[model samples]
Every structure is written in C-alpha cells, then in structure tokens.
Target: MSAARPRVLYVTDLAYPARGRRYGDEDVFLTSRLREHFDLALCHPLDATALMDAYDAVVIRNSGPVLGYQKEYDAFRARALGSGARVYNPLSGKADMAGKQYLLDLSAAGFPVIPTVDRAEHLHQLPAAERYVVKPKAGADSLGLRILPADGLAKLAGLADGTVLIQPCVDFAYEVSFYFVDDDFQYALYAPDPERRWELRPYAATAADLEFARHFIDWNGLDHGIQRVDACRAPDGELLLVELEDLNPYLSLDALPEEARDAFVTALTASLSRFVHAAQGTQEARETLIPA
Candidate 1:
C-alpha cells in the first residue's frame, strides 16, 4: 500500500487584478507543481477558514491584499491560531505578515531600512524632500499610498496613531528583490526602471548584497516558508531596505532560469514536507495529552 499524501489547502485570490503582475498565472503554475507532492486544492482566501479543517495544512500564497477581506482574514487567523491549525508560513512572521510597522521599527533601530516615521511630530526625523510617501500602517500592494509635499505634512498628524507611515520620497536608481526559501537564498530579480516596477530581470547579487538581504530574513526568524527582501539602490550607490515581505510574497518564478526555478521548487517542496512532519508531531503530542 502507498503512504497517504498530505492534503494542502492552497489559498489564493485567482481574480485579484494586481497592478503589474499576474497573480492568477503564478498561483496556477505553483499549485500545479505543488500537486506533485501533496493532494492540493485551491480556494479563495474567504473560503480558507471553512475548508482548512479538511486539509493537513493551509498554504497561503498570493491571497491578494488582506485589506480586501480584513474581517475574514482576521477570522481565519484567529481560528487557525485558536484551534492550533497548521498554517504554512506559521503565522509568526514579524515583518509584513503583521503590518508595515516593522519599517518604522527597523528604521529607528538604524538598520539599512528607509527612514520611516508614523507621526507628524516626528516629521523632522526624515530628510527634507520635495515629497513624502504617506501610506497606511496596514497597507499592501501600494494601496492607499500617497505622495504629499512638505506643506501637507501637518494635515497627516491626526491620522498617525499607529495607523499610517511616512517616508521621504526616495530618488533611488532601481529596486531589487532577493527571494528565499527557508533560510536558503535563491535567485534575485530587479526592476531596472523605476517606473516599471514589475518589469523584472535577473539580478546578480554580490556577497555584500546577500549579507544585506539575509539580515532581515534572520531577523524575521521564520524556520520555513518563502520571503522576499525588497531593497532600492540609492543614487549614492547604497541599498536601502524597502520592505521585508515575509507574508504572501509574489515569487517571480518567471524571471528565473530553468535550473534556478527548479532549485526553488525543490527547496520549497522540502520545506513543506518538514512543515507537515512538524505539524503532525504537534498533533500527536496534543492527542497524547488528552484524557482517555
């Protein structure tokens, strides 16, 4: 008899029309590959909570912005944590998984992150720029983001009760993202042109670049799952942390070479297997503790 394959509920929003990326296409390709190892079923984010109980684990991937279904997402999170349901990414991400606050925290801590301040009173902390980027603390996919001149800074004061983030508009040369699976570094992609953020090409990261990107991954402390370290090369030739996406980061698998893509899939498959085995151990431990 064959061993039973673990069942995975892959959560995604197939209809989410992302600005420059095809969320549906990526998820479709990923789910197809994942089916080789697990009995995978795809579901929209809203249905995850209901369907998750039937699966061995829930894999949240390109589920679209939580802003679209914050209530339902919160409910799903609460249920998963409360019930001890296995969730890939483990629901313990300290970066974007929680919110944008990490940017400010990292900035204050003097990491290589772009300087971020949430309160208008702290506006002086930011360098003088003709414009400042104002975004919600809980924002994603650039939703609810705005650029305002210095004169408009005071108006944003009342809205900063841990609800918004402010940063000087950076005049960066380009943006690059480093992809990782578990603690292993994978390939990287970069947007050569600032206007075309999603027009990515293969990026050759140097030793220093890898070190910079790995710092946040180590800081996030996720034992398994995917992560993207987004950074921008300033005009002065220094990379500043733009965002640490440890949530449902869109992997630009299309940009990687065949061998690199295959390597990523292999790493991810191993990570998922480890995650399933660990979850099974936890379940068994709990069952052992239960009274007969």
Candidate 2:
C-alpha cells in the first residue's frame, strides 16, 4: 500500500475584487498546480477554521485583507494556536501578520524602515516631509489610510488612543519586492513607475539588494511558507522596508515568465512537502507520548 498524500485545506477568496490584479485566476492556477502533489481543497477564509481540522495542513493564499473578517480571523488564529493546527506561514510572524506595529518597532530599532510612530510626541522621530501618512494599526490594503500636512498632526492626538499608526510620506525612485520560499530567494519583481505599483516587471536583484532583503527574512525567522519583502529605492539609492507580508501575500505569479513561474511552483511544492512531513512527524511524536 502507498502512503497517503498530505491533505491540505487551501484558503482563498476567489471573488475578491483586488485592484489591478485577478485574485481568482491566480488562486485557481496555484491550486490546480498544487493539486498535483496534495489532496487539496479550496475554501474561503471565513470557512477555514471550521474545515481545517479535516486536513493535515492549511495553506492561506490570496485570502484578501483580514480587516474584512477580523472577528473570524481572530477566532481562526486562536483555534489554530490552541489546537496546534498546522497553518502555513505559522502564526509566529512578527511582521504584518500581527499588524502595522512591526513598522514602529523596526523603525525605532533603526532597521532602514520608514520611520513610524503612534504617539504624537514621537512625531519628531520621523524625517520632515511635506505630508505624513496615517493609517489604522490594524489596517491593510491601504484601507483607512490618509495623508496629512503638518497642521493635521492633531488627528493622531484625537484618536481614542493607540488605534492608529503614523509615518512620513517617503519619496522613492521605485518600488521592488523580493519573493522567498522559506529562507531561499526565488525571484524578484519591481514597478519602475512609482505611481503604478501593480505594473510589475521581472527585476534582476543585485547582491546588495538580496542582502538587504535577506536581512529581514532572517529577522522574520519563519521555517516554512512564502514571504514577500516589499521595499522602495530611496533618493540615496538604498532599499527601505515598506512592508513584510507574511500572511496571504498575493504572489504575482502571473507576471513571471513561464520558466520562472514553474520554478516558483516547484520551490513551493517542495517547501509544502517538507512542512507537511515535519508537521506529521511532530504529531506522531506527540501521539506517542499520550496515554493509550
């Protein structure tokens, strides 16, 4: 008899109307390819927690912003953690998975991120700019984001308290993203035109670029799953962190050439296999310790 293939519950919102992207087509393509390796089933983010127990692992992909279903997402996280459910990307992420708080933390540590602060007193910490960007700490997808002038700093003070985050608007030459499978680099994409972030093209990453991206990946310390390091090329020609997306990051697989796309799928498939086997091993070990 052959060993059973790992059963995976893939979470996605196929109907999500993402700006400048096709969430459905991307997820469909990925799940189709993934089905070749696992016993895969697709479900919406709201339904994942209910169905996750039936599978060996849950893979969250293109699920859209959690803000839309914050209550359900919180429940899913609590249950997954409580049950030791195998969630790809694991819940240990210290970056965007938690919230925009990581930006403030990273900025204070001088990690080449755009300076961020939640309190009005710390506004001086950020470099002076014509405008500042303010958004909710728990926000995503540019939802609830605002740009304000110096006189508009009062908005941060009137907030019920720590419910928002603030950052100075950065003028960057362009935006680029580095995609990684686990700790390994797979490929890179960039938007040459700053005004059009989603018009992406394949970018050949330099050694210094990779080093800069890897620094954050290393900081994240995820042992499995895909991560995207979003950065901008500053006026001084240095990369600065824009966001570290570890949760349901939209992989622009459609933008890649066939060869690169296939390579990414291959890398992801291998990573999932390893992650499944590792989770199975841990479960078996735990079972052995339980009283019969």
Judged by TM-score, which candidate is best?
A: 2
lDDT of model number 1? 0.90
- lDDT score, residue 90, model 2? 91
- Candidate 1 TM-score, C-alpha based: 0.95
**Residue 56, model 2, lDDT:** 90
Q: What's the C-alpha lDDT at position 251 in model 1? A: 96
Candidate 2 lDDT over 1-292, as tens digits, reads 0158999999999999999999999999999999999999999999999999999999999999999999999999999999989999899998999988899889888898988888867777778788888899999989998988867767656652677888888889999999999999999999999999999999999999999999999999999989999999999998999999999899999899999999999999999999999987877899999999
Q: What value does the lDDT take at residue 20 in candidate 1?
A: 83
Candidates in order, TM-scores: namely 0.95, 0.96
lDDT of 1 by residue, 1-292 (tens): 0148999999999999998888999899888899999999999999999998988889999999998899999999999999888898889999999998899999999999889998867877998888888899999999999988778867767656668898889999999999999989988999999999999999999999999999999999999899999999987899999999987999988888888888888999999999998878777899999999
Residue pairs with backbone atoms closer than 3 Å in model 2 (clashes): none
Count clashing residue pairs per candidate: 0, 0
